[model samples]
Target chain A: MAITGVLRPGHAQIRVLDLEEGVKFYRDVLGLVDMGRDSQGRHYFKAWDERDHHSVLIRQADKTGIDLFGFKVDSEATLEKFEKDLQAYGVTTKRIPAGEMMNTGERVQFTLNNGHAIELYADKKDVGNGLGYHNPKPWGPDAERGIAPTRLDHALLAGGDLDQALDIFVNVLGFYLVEEVVAPDGMKIAVWLSCSNKTHDIAFLRHAEDGKLHHVSFWLETWEKVLRAADIMSMNDVPVDIGPTRHGITRGATIYAWDRSGNRFETFSGGYPAYPDHAVITWPVEHLPEGLDYAQRKLHETFLTVFS
Target chain B: METQKGNTTSVMTEEAYEYVKITIAETGESFDCSTNESVLEGMRRLGKRGIPVGCRSGGCSVCKCQVVKGEYHQHRPMSTEYISKQELEENCVLTCCIKPKDNLEVKVIGKMHKNVCEK
Candidate 1:
């Protein structure tokens, strides 16, 4: 009963350098279940345990970055209500047909001031997680297939107008500011927002580049699992961006790595739960390194400068 | 004829090979593997399809295993972040980086699977 509007982050359409290689990487290395390709030639995948049809969509292109990110709303009424809310707030919105995405109903899409594409959808057919509701085994074969993350968790995006972006999410979408890093002059440099409870569902940073994707994170089950993910990265030669470390902001144990296309992804575990009534935590700009990597307490130049 | 550890495995170092016997503790499946490739590589060569795979290069730990009664070498450095020095001392090894240095009985000991809210 607590979550009534935005249920969770639903899907992200990402561009890759090569579709077949991306498919193999996502299917065999990352362990996402390939749901097959559409006439549009885009590949779709769902985490083994996700009930939704797909959470990641990749298409081959000259560049690599996110095209759009979507959230699942509770119902069609909520979808309509949000559309009206966005229009009332002076944001332009468009309706995409139900079948635009496989098994998905309809989506109301819009672009934030920072230029990141965002969407809200009411329905997607759920494909049970291979384990039936009654008398289910812990996992099936796909669970052991690759890096096998459970679902797409959250994404950190880079943009110039972080304040306007934060306002849109908090004021328009009913999200809460979970954490933020503020410059000494009192302007926020980065902000984490949550629609439901498990820490940040999406985050934004101040970057000169508009609509840059910092990383799309996947949740590992434990600190140990995050470590194992790091090992997998070494074995496969995935370029490790950072971690097998802990983040002071969310208390998440993490490892950031890149796919072949140069897109960043994270395997992390642990984040303290926050409620709407909880006070937001603020970190001074100088203390950002501690917030980004608690153990090292060093601001990684690459982390601050690089986004794909 | 068998090759022993502490000596040249073969005439060519790059292609040198060592023989190993692996036991899949979960399915009670056993097979002979080689040091020229990882236990994971051996599993695939033998059509053994149970152990998980990721980053086949050693960056992700989908193929973590444990040595029950023999010695092995990590061809690469494993992150202590995931497998602590203590766990490595306890005989856990990433199969992707694992190379048999002795006739060994290894167990697939990693406990990982898909989880809700885990992505």
Candidate 2:
């Protein structure tokens, strides 16, 4: 089976506030086998997957949001073909500097359908040799091995211009809209789009204000693994914000929890399949009478209005 | 969306009554609040109005807090679909969703308004 425009299941890319600290957490504490550090100290890690190089990359930055998410295609030819299709759709595309592309370890840059950033190239590094430098007195634990993640699942972004963003995603990137929720004033509030069969590989929320990455998703083996992970969190005394519920859009039962650092995480399983082709669906925004706000409606509680 | 005015309700039932002693870690101020109000609300009531809360719903994860001591009950279940169950069990409760079930103590985990201005 050749990879398509869709991201391989479980591939997630995130930005970290402190690169060095993130390395200690993911490598030393969690025990993820560190692939190696970039010249700038950007660290990469591979999970229990057969992919050549790192599945997750963390770069140090003062602020955090979706830095970039990469999708695996069958070959460079597939990537070039997708690029041409994007141009035909009137979506501007950029070639990444070879350096910035993960394994390429060189400069490379690319812009996707909705102006979302991407870096595509091939150069996975080795993980076992000098790559495994010992920071024995590392921050977390010596014996701690990160719970092997299956893959980097999805990325969620909060955008101000929902319609425009959705248009680029559908027309240019060849993604399908799975489901959406509308605001009472007839504005799109949230949308779930997919480039793969596992429900949605990406989701966008119309922020009441600006655009930013909301959160990211990672899929585990089963519902039991989700709960077992929850129990581990309980044993570690981490606070559980919400969960063990089914999502209305994906129909996937999942849990929302946070890590020690303030970032949010979702562990989900059994989401519905995506549309066969790139099917774009739009829902007009309209005001809901009284019990219409999905956030309040579904949860039956008043969410604090902090965006304004 | 309709720009509705904020409404306050004074109704209280025995089941909705839980007492919590909250200590603002940043300022070292302590106050008591009823279960009817959230931790952020309780902070507001105590005049330590520096906590920045947007999207009072658990969706934002902005009003995040670390439980220093005691158990707090969430008014409703949070969607693990966004945040993970592991994070919740680690004692990272959103102040907006949290209602005191006991005499609880908490620490605001994220950047506060005062911290933002200092820079």
Whole-model lDDT per candidate: 0.78, 0.55
TM-score of 2: 0.62
Candidate closest to the true structure, highest lDDT: 1
Top candidate by DockQ: 2
For candidate 2, the share of real interface contacts preserved is 0.03
lDDT digits (tens) for residues A1-308 of candidate 1: 99978989999898776677678777877788999998898899998889899999998765567899999999999999999999999999999999989999999999987879999999999888889889999999987777888889999989899988898899888999999999989999999999988899999999887888888988777887787777766555465668889999888999887675656788878998879899999998999899999999998755775556
Docking class of 2: incorrect
**The TM-score obtained by chain A of candidate 2 when compared with the true chain A:** 0.74
- Model 1: fraction of the reference interface contacts it also forms: 0.00
Cα lDDT tens digits for candidate 2, B71-95: 7877533323224566577776667
- Model 1 lDDT vs. the true structure? 0.78
Q: Give TM-scores for every candidate, taking all chains together and pairing residue i with residue i.
A: 0.73, 0.62
lDDT of 1 by residue, B1-119 (tens): 01111111222345667577777777777777777667776776576776764433333344677777777787644433235566677777667667777677766654353121122
